[model samples]
Target chain A: MQMTKIKHHLTDALLMGYAAGTLPEAFNLVVATHISMCDTCRAALAEFEAVGGEVMLDAEPVDMAEDALADAMARIMNAPQTSLPKAKPAGGVFPAPLRDYVNGDLDRVKWRKIGGGVSQMVLKTEGGASVRLLRIPAGTAVPDHGHRGTELTLVLQGAFVDETDRFGAGDIEVANEDLNHTPVAEQGADCICLAATDAPLRFNALLPRIAQRFIGI
Target chain B: MLNEMHTLAKADAVTVMPVYKRTGNAGIRATGANRVMAEATTKRMAWVTQVAAVRDAKDKAAFAELFAYFAPRVKSFLMKSGASPDLAEECAQEVMVTLWNKAHLFDPAKASVSTWIFTIARNRRIDLLRKQKRPEPEDLPWGPEAEPEQADAMGLQQETEQLGQALAALPAEQRKLIERAYFGELSHSEIAAETGLPLGTIKSRIRLALERLRHTMK
Candidate 1:
């Protein structure tokens, strides 16, 4: 995959949580997808994971069963000797992680219209957070909204301009309850994003508020 | 949770540190920091060699040595993460088998052996306990073409060692918090609740290692 200039990156807490294997699956999807596209975050994740390595190293040792090594050796004999295939060139705009969720690339996503020229497909995930793929037609504006909790929006195709700034491909915008803003797709291309929200969003406009009930966003 | 993560945002803002840059023979100096760094480099490179022996020769003796040292530790790690003794034992064995199988993929420049094992074990925990799908980043387009430069590997190993030392040296309370987080005792929300965590203290060392890895990638 070609590298895009990624100005926004994951936070330390999210990185640490991912490294520690504590993030909810939806959030892990977002983190993995973002890291796939952004080398900077990938390097940061390695750092966080190193901390986990040290933690494990420093744990008090526990003795294994008397026959454990022999058992493992036998198992190793039976186990297929697998080596990682070298990474393939990406097939589309969605990275490997996102593609796994979609079952393929962009075309495979099963989107449901939420109204106003926007469509989304929520992926199955466990725990409290929810992740989805959103497609916004070019020049369309998503209704103004404030988050009830943390919302992570990662641009996958094209760009969007919010009150905060412009987010292009590979840029992730981390929004919490404190910020309320309207985001509009840039005029040139339809914007596709991978968004994960820990809680339901509260729409600023009344009509979409009713739509939110049916939309399950 | 928002309040705590907001604090995280603030903490992140103030903690960025300069990457540790090295020049020729800089690690050889006898002065305090350099001496410690060089010593760490020496002490930590052995694991890399042991992993290579397993990969290149399928050396059973080397595998035995590694198992003897790391298996018990891996068990301990799993147990701490709330695995039952039996489950932890079973999974720890699986983790070792994975290590031997994937030995060829080990990249010393990117991660120390322990770090690599930690990732494998971590994935196993998520799979075995949570039964969750763990999404991983795409691998770099190119695999390590050959054994990486010894210096780059050594530098990473040294940084990892220093990071361990720093964790050991942290005050008991802060260290316990970090340990709890790593041990899977703390959820992300719970980790956010901890206002006094010293995560910033170790960020610089990690950043330094990242810079080296990035430089090597280039």
Candidate 2:
């Protein structure tokens, strides 16, 4: 079977930092969001957590204050509940079709229209699971491009098709820089996806030759 | 209730019994009575406000309640991240205390409390790791036992025993790759490099492995 390579750096960074508990709060939020939606990343994270847990069992024990447990509970009894802050998308609430596609702390992404037919939103999650949301206009075709790194894409709405396969809402495609393919939106709709990539896109189109200079697709 | 009281009495005895045993049973009775009174007071006030009431009050009781549930988990997390046990313990306590002080700062609409706590623990763990000098390669803490093979064996054994059943149920290639990556921490590149397979193949294997694991875990 022909295979597609999913980028590894961002996912690896996310798993490593998540396992080590070294991810920053803002980035961690994005990882959590992505994990909520991405089964592959979620399972990868669980494995990392399990490994970390095993490592902890090997560490020497630290004694809490004899009264620490009791004190903690007492404080709990006296504590109060409050509303937590919501993470609003930096650009604004995403359209409904895009919600399932995006993950992580929403505030961290900086969305910019980098191309005529596309808008890109970038998110930095720890361990390199940086996120990019790409929205392609209806009937437009993205430059035939290969990745210099692994890329994972989840379609939130609409449809796109390459020579090998069709991606519809909720379909996930993992690609690498080795395989270059142009994705054209299916008739009558735009294609929006949540993508995690390690490096820039290598545009194969004449337009992108000029376009890539400014956009770094 | 009597069982709980007995446990409390035993715990309290460590400090009080030494003095009471020499001073006479009078002090024991006094201390026991005091514990009973304290326990009763705690129970009565437990209902003073539902823990969730902290949401509106300047102080949040629910945050404390959640911290109590997860702080130990966070402490163990730090230790695993390579913080000395002493450091881990200190950091754990600090996190819980911060939870208390910052309870009002929580915003549930953005992430669950567990996720929020996990983020805090993650940041703190990073801070602690960044401050330390790297350990000598030889001095690196080995697995708790001397047998590296046995450790991997046991880890696989347990993973298979618990997750093995699930593994058996996965596609053959997926299971193999998962065993290699999840248990081995082999990167896709490393897996490909070692197996002499293309990187794409490794990615698919891992992706499939994870998908299977997710289904099994669920």
Candidate 3:
């Protein structure tokens, strides 16, 4: 089997938060997507989950409302269909997990050009974080930028190399305020990524900065 | 092989939950309590087997047993994590419903029944909190997909027992941080700010504690 090289795995803090269900949806998506591809992180997550269960078992009990079980039964009887949503095929580029969000294949994504041969389509989700799919034509470079909050980018197709490392399909890059980089997609194919950011990016140049405001990035 | 057997034998000597069980029937706390406690322990340990029954056979009896045991525990958990009593009750109810709806997705290798139910409770509570402000997303995965391989029963049993031992051996300070992160539902920064510790210290303490846990349990 040819293993996908994923050099930049998520930090322990993020994974713990994800396991405990404390992270926002965007962060959870990144964590879940990365976990689908990385066995190492999946194991770490299992440990954290084990810890979560132990704490729960050890917690002092509080009396529940008398009708809680009956209420639960009522809800279950009327629960929204329990069947797993059938994720429309997204071919090979987008995994089933990501396809569920976009709701269709690559052709169905609603991309808007954000200038500089790059386009983005924001996926609406609950919570404050911003999540979007980005498309960069071959050899195109995003603005050199820092972060105001955590940003996680997972490469879906093609490849992008930044100041820190090169990421191909299935690899993830986690960036925060301490880091700054210009991510340029390698030539030969267009780079597509699912990027989730809790806050706006910090761009160095004036043109991109103005575009960022308009693009709602 | 002999060494592993020896470790397993030594592990069987420990009964870890005596320190943690909530007080029941204060008048009978001294007498007959041990029997009640033993029965409870047996019931708790067998929860995983019951969960598997729910998964494989759609056993209503098994699910009822789970609901009776876990519903109050989940409510207590949510309340301790700063939710109101009523909100906790509602979240717990929702969590149980999800359990019934999604029982087929539960895998013993991925987590113990307690762990699986705990994650569901935690997520359901968070979803309730978020639903107040915005609509919930329809696309989130069922959860982190652990490997598909069915784990060895003896190995999994030993891991759970050793996990309790590892948790018991942890220093109180490190244990508190872990409890706050997992059960108290506080993020690292929130825990740090609430505890007046530096963010880095909070992160490192949790990291160190998890490292010790993994080392010891393994």
The C-alpha stretches of model 3 lying farther than 4 A from their native spots are A1-3, A66-90, B1-45, B55-61, B132-151, B183-185, B188-218
Q: How does each model score on lDDT?
A: 0.81, 0.48, 0.67
Candidate number with the higher lDDT (1 or 2) = 1
Residue B102 lDDT in model 2? 57
Compose the digit string of candidate 2's lDDT tens values, residues B1-218. 33342254333222221211232221113256356533432222221221224434433333334434456666765665566777877777766666655554443211224434545565566556654211100111112332223222222223312232343456677545534442224444343323222123223333554454445544
Point out where model 1 deviates above 4 Å: A82-90, B1-40, B189-218
Candidate 1 lDDT over A136-207, as tens digits, reads 999999999999988999999999999999999999998988999999999999999999999999899999
> Against the true structure, whose lDDT is highest?
1
Candidate 2, which segments miss by more than 4 Å at Cα? Answer: A1-60, A64-78, A83-112, A123-129, A205-210, B1-77, B84-87, B94-218
lDDT of 3 by residue, A1-217 (tens): 1237667776777767776777777777767767666655666666677667777877777776655655666676666774866554433556556666776658879999999989999987777787899999999999899999888998878999999889998788888889999999999899999899988999999998998889988
Worst-scoring 10-residue span by lDDT in model 1 chain A: A81-90
TM-score of chain A of 1: 0.94
Model with the higher lDDT, candidate 2 or 3: 3
Q: What is the C-alpha lDDT profile of model 2 across A97-194, one tens digit per residue?
A: 23433443334345688776678875444444456677788888877888887666766567788866888754566687568888888877678767
Model 2, C-alpha of B83: deviation from truth (Å): 3.7
Per-model DockQ:
0.48, 0.12, 0.27
